[model samples]
Target: MEKISSTKNSKVKEWVKLKTNNGRKKFKKFLLEGRHPVETALEQATEYEFLIVQEDFDLGELAEQVDNDKLILVTKEVANHISDTVHDQGIFLIGYINEEDWQFPDDLSGKWLVLDNVQDPGNIGTMVRTADAAGFTGVVFGDGTADFYNPKILRAMQGSQYHLQLKRLNLEKWIRNCKDQGSVIFGSILDENARDYRKIDVPDQFSLIMGNEGNGMSERLIEMTDMNLYIPIKGSAESLNVAVAAGVLMFGLAG
Candidate 1:
């Protein structure tokens, strides 16, 4: 319900700061950008802390649907300072920082996903969305993975983050833990040892690991997996994008 006209205002400065990891950490929130992403966040996120809007942008019906106490009206120029995209989508949301650590269970009894250094935010986000739709229990981000809160990732996910059990993990340690639990870990790779994706006897509850964009899963992580699986491309393309690979595995095998 607070209206901020001054782009240089202290509060506006704080919102601008949310663009960075340190700032996001300190404030415990991130700016949810783009119309669809913001709308998805509004529906799934528990708290509606702030809705920043440009004065001329009509939120007409949307304004009525939101919690009135949490809205903030700002000038278009004022809002552009905090927006990651050049053309503002007329609205963005400030969502609560998720500080919760979804610990890896000792049993590894549930379906899960392990992303190892998949640096592309779009790929990572799409993987998360795929995992959610496929009924996977959670997605674990290994060291060197993209920041899940990165604007591109958030936008691509369309706000799927809130419902998923997410964790940034020490992959080697996490893999070792799962190994003892009868959980089969599949690494996406192109090695001679790699089996056609469908030929692998994927356990009912296991983890699928997607690795870096250029390099597939790390050597050590591949060793940690029960086996390696690859999509047999009839074409000559050397590799698939990590996210696209994940989507194929998720929907093809798991769906």
Candidate 2:
């Protein structure tokens, strides 16, 4: 194992690149900050690219659990340089990006969450996490959604990504495919014509499309859905946050 004290070290700079999506794509890797995400990675048996830690962070029993060959000790300055959060736990793991193509499951009896143009990283991550909690099969990230490896998104996910399938595909294609697979696709929209979410009966298997934060679902996708459902708000709020709305719908429809 190597001890790196300089932030200017080549290996340190390479790790820093994992902070950006483009950089992550170029390198085919991403960084998981702190213990929880790293613990999830370990539980999933994700291949270790590097296990970096500050000099003072005692490995304790954890040192025996992980591959010592991949371990690197770094100075406090170097740890700060690679970390995105102001208060990082002084430990991080470099893990490969999940680039495998996720096929539509042969048995389409499971619930699915489709995110269309949801730009907020926290919202995107929270929805993914909620989808996992609601027993959804997977999440399809449509075009214009935040990159899966964005730091804030990863932080928000809290390692739930390991528990569910995530894929990026065109929403139109996904919608058509879901229809062809005998799966009911419900679109969440705010239009006057949309049925109140409470009126719709939850099915054993379905695809729920949550759309952009500001504009709601696009017209083209809306037209393709079997039904457009809306959460009726009795309160004065203009609309529920996309993630919050998704939690309500996922639990109501998939729970």
Candidate 3:
């Protein structure tokens, strides 16, 4: 174990850079704060590179749960400097995120959720978590979606990202590929041509496309889908949040 007391230490500075998106990309690594995500990372067997702890923080529970040789102790100020959250947990994990070269799975027999240009981190994260809870196969992030490793998203996902397949692909290409593979594609768009989602006979395996927060599905994707499905708004509200709509569709289709 090494002691890193100063925020200006070389190692501390390097780790601190991970607080930024570009920094994480540059280093091919990210920081996991608080006890839950770190524990979840260990449990899921994610690449655990190293651990940073506050000098006076209690590590008894974490130590018993996760045994790691690369523990670095730092002062409270250093921990605060590295943590983005207001309530700093004092425990951080330096983990590597190996972006997988995910080809369209050869077996596309399970349900999947596709997100297109969904910019809100909270919405993206919640949708992924919802997909996991609904027992969907995976969630694909299309162009303009929020970063999967964003701290806000990481917190919103509540560690469910580790449980399911997450991939980044040109959604247009992905849709065409899935369509060629005999998979049914459904786009959520509220239009005259669209059918009520409840009326359609849900297929055993399918891909549901949830569009951007402000706009529904992209016109290009809407044209490409097998059918455009819409949920009727009976209330005074104009529309549901993208994540809420996704949950309704996911669980309904899964059932």
Candidate 4:
């Protein structure tokens, strides 16, 4: 295995760049940190360029799985410089981002979670993980939503991203496509005409739109949805967190 001792190493500088969106796009790679996510990526046969570990970090079974050519050992200082967390795990993998153009299918089916300008990395990760648990087929990231490559978002996903389909596209065009395919689109919002979430029958294949944390869904999207839903708040609390609301609706409507 190759060892990199200097924080100023050429490759070390490149790895640090993976932390940002532009860097990821430029390099066509993103950093996967921690044991679970790195292991999960390996198990899923993700295309990766390197399995990075701190000098003293134990690889254990992982040592047997990765080829020596793909392994790189870094000093503590190098690891610290590349880490995005308060407590770095000292293990990471650099995985290639899929650059193939994703074409929307002619026939759309299965339950999908749609994010409309949701910005929080934690919330985005929670919602994606929740969608996986709820057995949703995929997730769509609309304009203004956080990028999937964000380090915090990747960590928040906890490797759930590997199990589900994720896409970024214009919401207006996506909604129109779903409409053309005869799929029901539900928007979560509190409005005079919005129906109670419990009262609506869940469809086998549909898309649920969770909007921005503060602004909610856009007016154009609201008008375009087949039906708008409101989770009636019984208590004195002002509103549900976007991630929490998504979980409730995903499982509630999943049936």
Candidate 5:
């Protein structure tokens, strides 16, 4: 295995650059930290560039899975420099980002969770994990939504990202495509005029839109949805968190 002991190594510097969005865009790759995510990525057969580990860290069976040429042994200092977390896991993987053009499917089916201008990485990741748990086909990141590859989101999602399709798309065009395909589009809002989610029948093929954390759904999006839904708050809370609201609505509608 190629051993990198210096934090100032040319390769180490390039890997550190992946911490930013622009660097990831330029390099066309992102870093995966810790064990579970790296393990999941390997298990899913994700295309990867390298499997880097601290010299003393035990790889056990994992070592056998990685090609000899793709494995790199790094010193603890190098590992710390590459880590995004405070307490480093000492294991990491460099994964190639998918750059394929994603288009709306000709036939829309199954449940899809759409985010409109949702910027919080944690919230977006949580909703995606919840959607995966609810058996939704995928989650769409609309304009203004945080990048899926954001390190924080990648951690929050754990391994659920491998279980479902994820896409970045223009919600307006996507919604219109769903409408043309006869799939019901549901918008979540805080408006009293919207129907209570519990009272609505769940459709097998539908798209659910959860909007910005503070500003609810965009008015134009709300106008485009087949129906708008709101969850009744029996407590003193002003409103439910977007992720929590999405979970309730996704599972409720899934049934």
Candidate 6:
């Protein structure tokens, strides 16, 4: 393992760049934060790049659980220099992220959730974490969505991204391809034309389409859905947070 102590190092600059969409694309890596998520990656360490921890943070039980050779120890100043969050856990990991090489299951026939342009890393991560819990086939992220490799997204995903097939796709080509696969597309909406999400028989072979928090589903996606569905709200909050709505929908549709 390598130890880096300088905050001004070039590799540290590159890791900071990985925080952004363009940098992740250029470098082919993403940052992972917190002990839980780092443990998740280390669970599959053979596939991961390396752990980046600060001089000050605890390695947790991971020191006994994982190989020490896989870790990249750096100074606390180096961690603060590269982290997006102010409250640093003093530990971050650089996982190999490939935006262009998602390998889907050959028999991917089941419930799925499609993200249109979910900008919030928290929302993206929560949905993914729950999606993993509920056993959806996978998640397909369309253009304009937050960087899937963002540290926050990875952290929020809680390592569930490692378990499921995650695809970054061009909306048109993806939808067209999925049509042949046995995926019936369901779009979440509020319009009267939409049916209560619980009423429909969520196709065992389909993807539920969700869009931006404020805009709802895209017009094009709505037109393509086998059905439009909405959760019946008992409370009056205008609408559910995208992440919350997704968890409710995923359970209802797939559970």
Best by TM-score: 4
| Model 6 TM | 0.89
122-226, model 3: which lDDT tens digit per residue? Answer: 899899999999998889888778777777888889999887888877899988888888889999986746898889998887999999989878888888999
TM-scores, in order shown? 0.90, 0.94, 0.93, 0.96, 0.95, 0.89
**How many clashing pairs per prediction, in order?**
0, 0, 0, 0, 0, 0
Mark the 10 consecutive residues where model 5 has the least summed lDDT. 99-108
Compose the digit string of candidate 2's lDDT tens values, residues 170-218.
8888877777878899999976578988887777778899999999888
- Cα lDDT of all candidates, in order? 0.80, 0.85, 0.85, 0.90, 0.90, 0.78
User: What is every candidate's alpha-carbon RMSD to the true fold?
Assistant: 2.1, 1.7, 1.7, 1.4, 1.5, 2.3
Query: TM-score of the candidate numbered 2?
Result: 0.94
Root-mean-square deviation of candidate 3: 1.7
lDDT of 4 by residue, 1-255 (tens): 899999899999999999998899799899989998899999998889999999899999988889899999999888999999988999999999886414565556899999999999999999999999999988998878988989999989998898888887788898999988878999999664689888988888899999999999988898899999988888888888999999999988986
Ranking by TM-score: 4, 5, 2, 3, 1, 6
TM-score of 1: 0.90
Worst 10 residues of 3 by lDDT: 99-108
* Per-residue lDDT of candidate 5, residues 63-159 (tens digit): 8899989999998889989999999988999999887525565457889999999989899999999999999999988988887888889999988
Writing each residue's lDDT as its tens digit, candidate 6 over 1-255 gives 779999778888888888888998888887777777777777776366667887666776777965578677898788888888888787777777764445444664777678998788899988888889988878888887886787778777877888887888766666666787867777888765679986776556888788998888778877876778888777776888898888888888775
lDDT of prediction 1: 0.80
- In terms of lDDT, the poorest run of 10 residues in model 4 is 99-108
Off by over 4 Å in 5: none
Would you give me the overall lDDT of model 6? 0.78
Collision pairs in model 4: none
